[model samples]
Target chain A: MAYVSEKKEKGIAVLSTATSIIVPAILGVSLIFTMGYSSGLIYIIGAPYQLMSLFEGIIAGTLVFSFAGYIIGSGKTYRLFAGLAFGVAMFFTVYYIIHSVDYVVPNGLLTVCSFIITGAFLPVSQLATVIYHGRFLRGLAVPAGISVISIIVIAELAILYEDSGQSNLAQIVTLMNSVTLVALILMLFVLISRKSSGTGRIQN
Target chain B: MGSGSLLKISVIIVVLMFIIIAFIPVASTSGVKTQGVQTVELESDSGTRTPIKHVINIYLENHSFDNLFGIYPFDSYTSNASLSANLSVPLNLLSNRTARDMLTEIPSGTFSTKDPNEGYVSYHLDFNHGKLNGFLNGSGPQGLTYYSAAQEAPQWDIAEQYGLADNFYAPCLSESAPHHLYYVAGYSPIINDYGPPPYIPYSQSIFGELSKYNISYGVYLNNTAYRCASWDFLYGHTDYSSHLQSWNSFLNETSDGTLPSVSYFFSQGTGKSMGPPNIILNGEMLLLYVIDAIEKSPIWNSTAIFITFDGFGGYYDQVVPPVMDGVQLGLRIPLMVISPYAKEDYISNTQMLVTSILGFIDYNWEMPALNKMVDDSYLPLDFFNFSDCRTPIEFSPSAGFPVPSNIHFSLVTNTSADNYSSLFPMEPQIPLDKLGYNRTGSSSVNLSSMGVGILNKDEHGYTPFFESVGFYSMLVVLEIAIAAAIITRYRRK
Candidate 1:
């Protein structure tokens, strides 16, 4: 009788985990599409520029969520480092692919890719972290906090550079790249320190 | 899970979305006041005037006064004398007096393959504190370039027949986007920018005024992505969306004689003769089609067409624009007023701007001024003397003109006689050419043999492609994607 209740509790936890991630992913994707459509992308011929930026955000979010999930689910220091490294590599690769392409990929293909990445991969990865850790908000919070801070800092630097009469296009680009690199290094250091201290690792 | 939790989650999401949307700054329609102040009165031979029932504003893209209308034959007595006399006082001056002599500088058949840079910063640099000679040394390759006499033959022909405002200028020194915003709304606060984000709200516009009076108005766009149609302010408001229709709807209405009291026509952004990268001849042909439709319609007698360009697209013009309230007026642009009441072969040397159209609309409809700036500017009613509405003006459409083969070319190496012939075709030979005007100087270019290209087949090429797979398809795709996502989520559960 105790064993049956234990199995039921595990099942209920899995269901709860699935519900949490799936609902948010669906809501996020739907909100993004609605915003794009209502913003006059419906009348435009090809994919509106706004959708492309939204796609980049989804790609970055999926990478962070999945990497965090793998690190938390494994509950090992080495896995945490490995996952962080993989996340960084994937983020840069996706960014390079999006920026360097000369020809436009069809909007439909882009939409489908974005939807699959956000809806399927995001939920599955988030569910892993949620099930093992009983909550994944801490893991999610770290990356979200980092992203928000980096974006705000980058935006401020850009605005300041624009306001400065002496700054030119090349100088601004260089400044942004330097700031991004420094931010990346700082984030990696934080992740390494947390892993070494065994602060985020789950105990069996 | 229980249905109660699902309901709570949905409600929470809905409330959150509402909160975010509510913070997005809705445009206040309360602040704008209509002060009934009459600025300019029309001077006409007859004391009584025929009521103008319809006003059609057709806005074209980039071309300067000296570039398009430099060589247009002007009556020196009326244009020069009136402008000189009017300059003593604060009356609007005509174009012929303001424009610099380009007879020696720009050759008869000059052509360029390169497009000039006409960004906000570039325009400011080119202005050079109103010296106006910095075009050549400015940011772009074709900044100093002007359309030759041969290149401007089509527009010149129209100007000769209709009422042309030689001294008309763009209201602001900016790119197409801001200029377009200024066209519908007397003021555009968001200057020097483009895009879907930072959508402007409908706080101030001629449309809002028209709505108050219950006057009918429609904005017809050739391309959906044109700056005016893509304006977030209009799209965001449900009240104005129905009034925004396709360009074809305008044509159909003209044919059916069902056009609204006030109609605005915006050309396609590219390949429709908007200049720079696109061929200029394509734009002329589009204008011709609109004119032909209007001329053929029964509403021709009652309708008045105000054709003008939005701003100078980095073209060389010798005139230094006047400063108004710390902002330098943009360079001189070509303005033509076509109506039964428009003076025949008459050049009105009045200084006009995009605001003139709004002023005329306000005057005819007995509506209040859009704002103080518009109220101060000269109205275009001076272009028309309603003493002669009994006889309509006759316009011969330029038929069988060969469309330019190359849509894109550089100014340096694109000196083909064939490309030049597209502007001045020999077929249905131009009346000006018959009246001893040699369009092709020394070059022997045959226009009859040259085959029509993409432009002749369709003025706006592949425009139907968007119409065929339009908003419906977009919605369908959205619906399918959502359904698939929902199904996938359920299967995962």
Candidate 2:
């Protein structure tokens, strides 16, 4: 906050961060869901020439907000930056998977579910190394594992929705899908119990 | 400012410039997004029907004049003044379509035709180099045998009584769609449509025009018969169902004398679904069938049967195809017109395509409403002997040998000095390992979706899972790792 107030350049950084990281994550998700049946739609809509506006704007916005956050509270250095990047990458992947399913990914209900999985999976996976081994990014492992499980559950949902107008993801067509959902549910239970004492740093 | 800090400012400036350049567009287009490319829509190649009759046309798939005629036993057939001065020129004769598999590389003896089961990952014009952008190379038994040429031959022989063109050639060197487009339309721009697919539509085709005159046309395919989308547009616009024939229904054609003015018959898709190895002979057989039909039909002199291949199977031909867009389309393919009006021992050098067939129909019947893509392209006038108009004469179909599967049609080598040092990449020397088309079963024998000759030597054939977003994301990860290390070091200090 002080940096942006003290220097004009800091404000520009905030704008850059929003432009670069935030926009693509959102549009990329939206397109993935819509381009289901007409897979070929990727060619014209995401044309190379059009990238001038898409990817650039995203990186700019990401730079601004992220750099501003870094300066606040004794400068976050690289740990926070990496956490955010992993989270965004996870969101992008989820968006792509839903979009490529070759069928409409349901408007309100399915969309919300997809976002949840994206939000949970990425950080859990990246921080796994740190968590088990008691290292730098240990906090991220939980979110990363959760993201993997979420993909399975969501994939089951997408396929179920395609097969029937309404899908119960628990009824999986493949053994793998069912196994992932079961594991994620159990993992989520353990995580919630461990966090009940409010001793974990992840919340902050 | 001190030079030390000046460098940092410049670095910041460059990074900001790159980000700004990116943002200006990304921020603006955040509202818009797309999935894939859209195919082109244009007039189809189907022709219109009219009264005045006699039409003759021909198509050849991959064999170039030199590849087919270089070893032709012409001395025994036509003893000319010179030992064989002009024999290599295209002959409109009824000869065997089987030739020895051409070499995979340009110069003969330098490369083998034996295909490596490298998966599509390795399948490129050349594997070692990073360029897997163009077409697949195959050694003979002319990899040109996709359609059931042998099955259609009897029908074509009967129709050729009116005319035959010995000097026609393929417009491009690449594959099935481009050649088919060239045959039906004037230019093969459909191949160069770098945008979305369905580049040309049937509504813009010759068949589309023929529908205007109520002339019927049908293209029966099997499965998602992967070729030009124009085929679908034509079939769909003409109110014909594109029945996907199973292996058993391969020959189940319901078209009798009710056959449309232009009826295209193929085994559908590629490989085992097309029936046995005998399927490669479809082009020859279809022509014979057309010939038989014309002999039995009320419109004998008024019909034309075309037999052409989609592309050269990355094999070598001695001759140089005419250049388009600074790239060579490969050598001249062997095109034979089996018509009585076709001058015997006559060789014409006029370049032609599928559209010219429609153009011939337009000129003969004076149908002004033929699809313009075909009508718009220059007709292959030089190949036809226009000096005299003669009545139809019937010729007996000579029984050719049971068409051979093994033959050699070697590609000529690159002796050019600037092979690699040129401004851009050119076809490299054929790898010595690819000798013959021994990999006949290289393609999926039965499955329509499975393609044979999957080369995995280079990254060109297959898209890495880490392409696009994966690549950039990894770069971002690296930057984050660096920042993390810097922060950790600061904490320790």
Candidate 3:
């Protein structure tokens, strides 16, 4: 019985190792493609030059979070690094995008505040990981995977709108914005509740 | 494995992934592997006999020769074969001792200044009466920055595979409008960026010349065909108007293998113009589309694609414009010749003008020179090795390799939005004071002297409201709504 249990644990470990590497790799490629298309960098289908550096930042942040998370394992240290990475990514992405289009240069305080709001999700996500254990990452990966698919669908629809000569770009953008907002909020609420309700022995 | 081993493994895997992403060969969209320039040595006798039947002139927007091809023989980008082969060196900025102080290589993909005062007066100031050192004072450091193969891989790729003319010069030392005039008629009345038509007479253009000989020709405007007023600077030419067609018509003609013998594909407006804020990627994509279309056509073998710019819009060039009839030529602009008969791995040092296209056209059709100015111009025929016809080279973008489906084969149809405004602003408020013109702020140029009543007023106002609002509103609104939703959802939970 002891030997059998040991074998099962080894299998789980191998599966977990594969999962960590493959998931982020897949997510990284999809994230780049979707974000690139949305930003008009990938598809030259009449979309103008967008904030290329900003999109690059987002992709970098995602990779850093996933890879850093895997290396540090589930702990306060991983959460801290993840949050810091997210904060930096958020700040730069906002700064570059705003800069590219000649908006009022964001003040330091505004940039800090913006990143703080966005970076708050990192800690909340870690809380969910503690509560749901190993399965939590799989659950977290679901939203990103879905988002990648959703963006591609939206892009296809945008092309249809382009072909029809009626630019519903405004509407499509609004729809995407609404969906992202709702999804983020719902995930936060679920994670926060799972933590507050004391469902599992939350590790550090 | 232990947690420590797992951590090591994760780190290794993540680093590997990033390395792969970093080294992802740009211009892989065409799916063809990057090959070195095919060193097909041109025989001395090969240059005399020519077989080029169809001439497709793609007149693009501003870029100096040095700005685009300053660092030729790009050892890093091309293959060992190209590096090992005896490549002829053209008179580039790197080779010139006079331009040594001005040889500041900007990083690849960096855009020059937006709206660099590139009118006649400013360009002359930059020219500094042929001294060529006043670029810093005239157009700022932006005029000093030049690109290598890194920023313009597709261009360099085509140049490497076929022919690049390092000494090609624009006809006029001004902005788009004047150079465009000089391109068609080999002369322009105005020297500034804009002037209302006391225009060149209609019967004087190469179009008129072609029509007179019953030779097929076309002026295909890609972006601004229908929306733009038909203010053909040609005053009273009836048949000249018939040849001016839309982008779709050009594509259809190419598709049917019925493209005109002398076809001029004009890419203008916003991103399409291959100008500032460095959107050369868009230009490259468009070039690929056009080249691919031609390759697919039945007339591919006979067609010679002369890809040249109108003027180097305030960009840095070491070469001084040569004086002809008291009008100095504009800065040296890039000219890449791509055809089956174009000499492989060749760089022509022959001094040529934008009017040289007219010269080539006239020469090819066995017609008279458009004028004395054209007659004196050196033909760009030295770039071609007509004795040996090779296969068309496939090209891909340097960065942002577009998805195959995303490559729209057709140009703009009926879209009201001018996506190419960045390439050329639709409504330029001409700096009348700088140019010494009396016309203030977007006034119509009257061409009554040439019999055309008035130049068309730009209906589309210059408001880049689409970019800022279209991009940020989506991001900001989403963030705000998410914050609100999180508050509401968290309180309920």
Candidate 4:
């Protein structure tokens, strides 16, 4: 029974960690690919443009996050399954964006900016995990670094807005910021609850 | 508080945030503001007059106003013009409508879609008594497709720099033939594209009227000088055949200062029309060439160039056509007035038709009106500012993207086999010296509430939390402390 409980805790840690890292990476790469394809910076044929970018982003993101997971000492099998599950979750997240999010500018800069900003969730989640492990400064550093990167991204979006007067694109920006903030708070809550419940430490 | 108490409160707060996020709609952002008034006052101009001597009408093929300019200056990622510089607000997909509402009624259009069904009868079905919801049934989803400013760089650039008429309707609710007839004559006897012998029995025409007053007019066709033969066939008169000129002649005339008092240019043959096998890139290129030629000419100061489509070509437009004189008006088509006297970044909401061109001509030359409709039609004088002659704004001809090898047309041709470039010879290039000016400057402009002319601060400010550098700096300090703690813990492990 002790062994089973330990195995369950390990599984949960691997699953949550992989999900926190991989999903946002997929979304980030997807937005980049989409921006490139729409701007005519990238050439692709034979499939629908949006679908092709999404598929390519998933593959690239999966490969990248898998390496990161491996470096972090996660089990190979756990990382693989978690990657697949989170990839599917990211696909649905993009689908929701397509169906629900409106006010697309011709250049598609707004949608890409929003999704890239929402990608802050990855670092925020990492920060929570590190804090729960009693490495408060290290965890705080991760989000701080991400925040600086986000500022640069937002500055570019602001320049684009100034040039275009495309206030409509702001809808996606607001929606994405709200999602990222909520997810950050929720991740912290989940981590705090786990620590208070005397849950075993995440196996690094 | 104990860690357990802190955890409980955090969970509750997180849940509430998620619920709030879920309920927030994506369309809660600011939208384009429009005025309810019909006309707008120009920045420093009070009275209207005309400096237009040469009237040039460059007529292209089918496309509705909404099909091309649904978002107008905001159609592309770049704002082409300012809202303030624009005297009048245009009615587009973004006007008074949320993005969700737009997606529900008429989803955003895509590029490379098949051209939709368009004709006299089909247009009425699409009209659906002004509900404007019968596009799917009347012409299929293809009709609902619209081009972004990225795809229509030339049109958007010209409209933003000059004047765009959003409420200009086609004189007839039919295809190219009748609309063409309405252009030369104030009216069309037939409702559709085709009819019996003497397709247009209306002996009276704007061309004949010009000939009667000996005002000098030319019909320049782009394909070949020979296609002008159709003019005789359509009108049953060879009287104006002498006035028929080739595209090359038209360009040469602009520079030679021998351009006719009135000129009607058609790009039907050179694939410059925006119909089936819709090659908008070629159309844009053709327009740039024409504008470059005109702007460089001796007649540039005296010329007022009107660029418009002959018909809507079965694209989705939300506004229903109004009825007049027991005949229903046609779909809304885009109209741009380009001249030194033309209003800058202005949108004219004035209800107008093709006959308005005749009205302008009559008003300009002090000639009698062509007919009652021409007499009643609103003159395009409102689109010009006689008080101040704005210098000719140089527009870049670069499409800013690689042109597609070809655009496919599923309606009229076999898409798999018909490549536009391969089928037609490359358009003849005008001499660089003839253009007289080098194309410079980026196509984008800084747009505020009222576009380029007025510099109002943007109404939608940047995200507050994201733009706070101070907050981010604190976060960086916090992050550094956490990283050192992490290293210490790892060393112990």
Candidate 5:
């Protein structure tokens, strides 16, 4: 009975690491394909071309999140934060590079920055919750679910606002990003304090 | 619930999300029909509708509006007055410097040995946020060469006889490849200077939309592969392969009265024509041949031929292109619409892009726009006047003029030639197999002749067959990875 329980624990650890890395990577790639297909379809259905940047922001966001998740899932806290920082920096770097040379979508800078901030923070917070709550897949799954729901809500709101000519999409996306960043900062503060106070530890 | 059950549920949820995200786009676009006002209509012998039966797009190589059409006598003050005599109206508006004024500022010649800087970066510097003052200063002295009206007489004669669009801009501020993609796809997903990917799936192309509606189309090229057809959607798809044909086949079909509803003709680069460092006169001759072939064909009465250049080949143009999103619209290129329904001696000022051609086709067929950019709001269809279809306009082929006989020889001898040298190094070695129709797939119907065969390698080193294989290999890897993950989880059960 003791041997069986020990093997089960090891299996859970392996599964947890694998799910944490693979799930986010899959989500990132899947979101890119989805955005590409939907943008193409929107063109076919005669939607405005300006709206494509919104989907482009989603793709960039998910890609950054996946990169951060890969590092964090390896069970290295410092490395995970470093990766997130590097990803955000690189996002801005690439945007400026493309801007200097080729044409970037108008008002794309703020939208991409917002997406990176949201994507980086949300996933890290979910990982923090997992460490504290002692739940393996639930941590990742719940956050991903919330993200999916939030994206739909944001998209719908943008469309409504655009259709009604009440506000530009870039303004809406910037506002959302601002809110997400605030929430992310608060979550990070709580997680860091808990670790410093010896109240919680990430399971390996 | 056990951890295994929880894992299974998570996987199921991810899969469900993927399916839902994927299905939404397909569901939304599946049954939607084109809506809005129809732009062009006429009472024809067959019925009361658009009299246009055939649309042919003939793509020529680089030459800007000011470079070619600046001295074409479109102004009433000029000797060749075709439009209204209004001295107050500016013949060609320039925000900072005019093309005519720039003519004296830089090298004035028929042929340029040094190519001007027309890359994406150069375009940005030259545009300068619509200040438009950087033509002579941005790219040095090479930016000021404008072809004389005498040099471009053949094209001017055609424009004067048919219709001229003085304000059409190249869709994107890039090289030939992206603009060619925009010519067919309406929107180019590729932002950089890269050539067409080896294979694009059917879902990503306007040809896919045409195939769905069973609308017959063909792409005819001299000897080179049509850049637009290089996408997997047209080449890899066995059903659409036969639609690719040679220029000769196009002529034969036109004479045989078997031309497709829509057709595209691409020039046989420098050897025959396609300008810049090569002889400009040779390109004019090729244009004359194309116009003559259509004029003598049985389908001439029902056909509308659109002739335009892909982009300004490092030449000076007076107009500053409008900015949208982050992309600055490319400089103005000459556009001529020649059809029986085309208004005589008319000059249209409708602001248009290359995608306007695609828009025109979609409007006539009642097909949905390829993308939002290809919709009526972005592209102007007012170039054609179909009010009087009873009297069909006729055109006589311009008389042949003296062309430098040894232009090809001179280019071949000059081993140290620039980028334009490779465009027409020698006469294209046309493969025999590419001359006629080679049908594939389960369908017995021979749609058209397939003329896509191996040609001289491009500068990009795109091995056609190898690239397609690489794309497929990546997809296979993705599938295997997914399968492995699932099987590993199932074994733990």
Candidate 6:
């Protein structure tokens, strides 16, 4: 019976995430594909990089969903953490795959940089979008927002200096992970403090 | 507006700042070219130009050059980046930006533009042999492995029965998939959908044609071994047979042929196929079994077996795998073509592998070796110096005494993970538990402390494999620790 319920929960989460990413992905791809028809108009309207941003949005949205599913998934101790780790790792793996392709056109170096940016964009967007959904994760929101902003700052600087090296992107992601960990810790500390500080209400 | 939110934002900012700080060094190397990609075409000896009738390919894992971290005895562990630097070999190996227009034909006797500084540093044979021998005696250094010669580890005749392709290498000396692809396709691409539902054909595979012709191929697997399994498309469909066998039994059974014309065999988990082999000598033993077959089979006459690896598994090596066709070959994985016709004391300075396998078939059968093979040739048979005229010849098997130790190579280790005390004494190195791993019908146990691997061999050497936890645990442990510490600290106020 528990197994059945667990399966159901997983199914629903999958359905929801798919529904979310698929709709936007389709719309984004369509928007992207249509712009090719009017290259001049698309370029004028900033559609060239919009496609990149939309992808970032989708990744962010997906990561938020994964986070929610984990916190809500119940069962076991750290399903959410597992999911987050997996989702991010998978996200980066995809980026590595893009960077690895040999036959990429335009310029291999540029392609690699684009992939790194695209990868960074996803995590940033996820935190930005998910922070609000955490339902006043209260003080947690501040740390989360700063984390994203910091990443963008780093990214901008990296691009300014040059974003072609593998380590630049790697360092950025590694910092993001570390900060995220720190923020989560801080939020947990705040939550426990609140619970014990004479307020007899559980925030969840 | 809240201080909490401000704090959170500040932390994020700090993290990003650190990333930028870390990236300063990387950005400093701007405009540094990453070398160039190559497409090699080796020439075959003309006099004994018999078409390829039989080809056997073997893929061993993680055991680059030598088992340990040295190329000679008593050498220390090294940090060669050939096996697994995570950097895509194509980008890291070839300078596409600078050498985009330059078309330099690959010279013969060299595999890729091999940088002698990119792979895992391997200890010499003396180190490997001495270690294994000592470990088996239970009197060795007890370093990493205890797979001494006396451990009854499966042994086979290499270097002697086959003309050793000394300069042969793994496509990339690393992970399973890319190397496997190179084992069959010659080139390893960075694919998006690399895992699951093996038959999902996002790209071209040579096995497609082999399957189309009913040439006969099979994957002897355990676990969910069929990821990105398009190799089945080459044969109408693929079969997962030989699912369960004792390591000893499988070795004994498989060396004599109970199979098809083109068979793809891999052991599960720790039993050789999916391990770094510093722990279990599964990969080496498995190769030995294949060697045993070629050394004592009727098919040995007309048969040739090529052994190579796929990608460098983010380790290290000195010989950077070459770029064949377009993809980075990864690193100098060990490659050997076993046959009577192969060079006796041969050191083939050639970049040949899966594509070469396809090249062999394509040249002999008049088929187009897809992907890289289309551009490359079956690693030219020059590794086999055919000074005299010869037609396609076939050899008979099981003719000799077939001693297992004719060319003995045993595994040993002094710093077994069971006790890396000499290395990291401050770290509590309890034999960590390898949880949830087992073979078919075997009870699960903690593999870490058990002095065994993912598949612990029993007295008779029958072992089952289990699903790897992957990196799922590290995150969990960290999460729990931080959660606990944070909760305690906040409550203290």
Q: Which candidate has the highest lDDT of all?
A: 3
Candidate 2 lDDT, A1-204, residue by residue in tens = 877655655454444333222222222222222222122222211212223332332333233322332222123324444555645654556456555642122223233423333332223222232212223253222333333333334344444543432211112222222233343334334444545755342211
Worst lDDT run of 10 residues, candidate 5 chain B, spans B439-448
- Name the 10 consecutive residues with the lowest summed lDDT in model 1 chain B: B452-461
Best candidate according to TM-score:
1
Q: What lDDT score belongs to each candidate, Candidate 1 first?
A: 0.50, 0.34, 0.53, 0.52, 0.50, 0.35
Q: What DockQ does candidate 5 score?
A: 0.03
Model 2 chain B: worst 10 consecutive residues (lDDT sum): B439-448
Q: Is candidate 1 or candidate 3 better by lDDT?
A: 3
Comparing 1 and 3 on DockQ, the stronger one: 3
lDDT of 5 at A95: 45
Q: In candidate 1, how many Å is residue A78 off?
A: 33
On residues B90-142, what C-alpha lDDT tens digit does candidate 2 reach at each position?
A: 33222433322322212311111232211111112322122322223322233
> Comparing only chain A of model 3 with the true chain A, what is the TM-score?
0.35
CAPRI quality of model 1: incorrect
User: Candidate 1 or 2, higher TM-score?
Assistant: 1
Off by over 4 Å in 4: A1-204, B1-49, B79-88, B96-112, B201-203, B224-234, B397-493
Compared with the true structure, what per-residue lDDT tens digits does model 4 show for residues A123-195? 2333333333324353333333333443445445435533432222323333333344444444444545665
What digit string (tens of lDDT, one per residue) describes model 1 on residues B287-368? 7667777887878888889998878887767778886545568888888888876654446656667876776776676655
Error of 6 at A160 (Å): 37
Task: Evaluate model 2 with DockQ and give the value.
Answer: 0.03
What DockQ do the predictions score, one after another? 0.05, 0.03, 0.08, 0.03, 0.03, 0.04
* Candidate with better TM-score, 3 vs 4: 3
Chain B TM-score in each of the candidates: 0.66, 0.48, 0.68, 0.67, 0.66, 0.46
CAPRI tier for the interface of model 5:
incorrect
| Deviation in Å, model 6, residue B395 alpha carbon | 18
Of candidates 2 and 1, the better by DockQ: 1
Local lDDT at B33 for model 6: 16
Q: Name the docking class for model 6.
A: incorrect
